[model samples]
Target: MFTEAQLYSPVTRTGDGDVTVHLSTEHPGVHDPAYRARRNAIAACALEYTSGAPTPRIAYTEAEEQVWRTVSIELARKHRGLASAEVLAAARRLALPTDHIPQLDEISAALTPLTGFRYVPAAGLVPLREFFGSFADRIFHSTQYIRHHSAPLYTPEPDAIHEIIGHATQLASPRFAAIYEAAGAAVARLRTDAALKFLADVFWFSLEFGVLREHGEIRCYGAGLLSSYGEIDEFRRAELRPLDVFAMGTGVYDITHYQPILFCAESMSEIEDVIGAFFESMDDETPLRARHLPTHANVPVAQ
Candidate 1:
């Protein structure tokens, strides 16, 4: 369990006043012994947790087999019900192993080839630019580790459940992949903290906690929403809001709890295409909410 202070503290909402981004966890992900030593080496000087720190330390905790199994099984089952048939088909074709509640290794291996997308088990929460940059290179900044069992239902941070499921499956769609890269490239080309935050909001609303319309029915797809058993019911049943609805709220209010409002794209292709164009148009503009990342600090945002 996290210390009492960690459990009750206000989440650190970085950037401007409105869009409160919560740091999900001390980066969670497990790696094989080889990668454990080689990851940073592969990253070279580019690997940084903060501007001042060139290398970030990774943290690990043992999740009893049962605890890990419970979530893994639950996530797989949820994936069946909520994830598109297309994603599940891809999961099967990939023969993706759930590996002892699976870690980043399994996800990275499964995705790296399929979509040129790989998961980077984050050592900790990274700032906007770094996070966006990961996508720019076809890398998904993932927390290979899961949240502590105590968190049970919902947490403010992205853990394995959020990382692997929340975002990866969508990459299976070539159009989505193209759009993702386009968005990342736009951010990479622009290279600023503010633009990254805007993209993050776009990510949070669309990829992490978004709903999509399919075959005359709405579907559960976002990893962030899928992993939370409680949120799943509410999100699936709640009134749907368009993506532009939430885009308007960016940087104005830090969103927490179950998002009362959510934006649904008319179609993945349409959304992805629009997202690409949005990034292109805003390529060099600074976000009003962008700010420099702080080192060795975890600040909680106000609720």
Candidate 2:
């Protein structure tokens, strides 16, 4: 079975600059020729792009627009009750359209004013170093394809929904943007694969899937949970442990399933102090030392 990362990043370019998106048999779009063609067309747009140029635009089909509309309306309803106040405020400021799929350039235009962040197209997997390192420059590499329309609320891989709705809203916040840049800077300072993986794992736990306490509720701040229809409803049921960098950096998780364990912050300030500080100070030796530290005891799972 393909790892979740591999599943999401199935596009590859050949020596001659041709783009091919390999869909696993389990992928919903694998048997659909129309969906496959659309994936190729969208990936080609990213393949043909040059940095600092206008982000490409896609004329989304009515079906595609409907998918976006369905997800946007549903996620908005869930966010009001499950998302962190910081995320809710950022979403309001970003003001993404609920009736149509907003082009990446439009998303960039909004983000640039808020936090100096901009979007660049990715045909698929950007190398780990480049992906994380680009955060230092306020650049986000995003995929442009929507998921197969048959299951609007279920995607086997990260789609445009995950890129724009999941990440763009979080990027709208200055504090979250600062944390992203810090992670990018930490990636630049690291020298080993081990250290990079450690940083990525920490990032996965915190920014991609982190949660925090707000107004007596365990609300979501992580883009992974925020963008996920099912995950938004299920995260509070996961084991909610306190933030522990050592554990977060060294922990193992299966991205394909609802995460069974999560690290929660006492507040947004705690996220900054713990996750932000770790990213700012991390280096090649950090994970080495972290591995030797005793793990924090798990807190009682959220009721």
Highest TM-score: give the candidate number: 2
- lDDT, candidate 2, 240-260, per-residue tens: 888888888778778778998
- Candidate 2 shows a clash count of 0
lDDT of 1 by residue, 1-303 (tens): 111123221223225422222232442222233323333332322233333232232343344334456666676787776665555665565554454545555666667777787665454455557666667678777554345455444555555565655567666555556667776777667765555556666666766667777676666656667667667767766556655512432523234466665566556665656555566555545344223212111221111
Q: How close to the true structure is residue 213 of candidate 1, measured as C-alpha lDDT?
A: 70
Error of 2 at 222 (Å): 0.5
List candidate 2 stretches off by more than 4 Å. 1-4, 15-17
Candidate RMSDs in order: 11.0, 1.8
**CA lDDT scores, all candidates in order:** 0.54, 0.90
In model 1, the runs with Cα more than 4 Å from the true position are 1-64, 245-255, 285-303
| True-structure lDDT of candidate 1 | 0.54
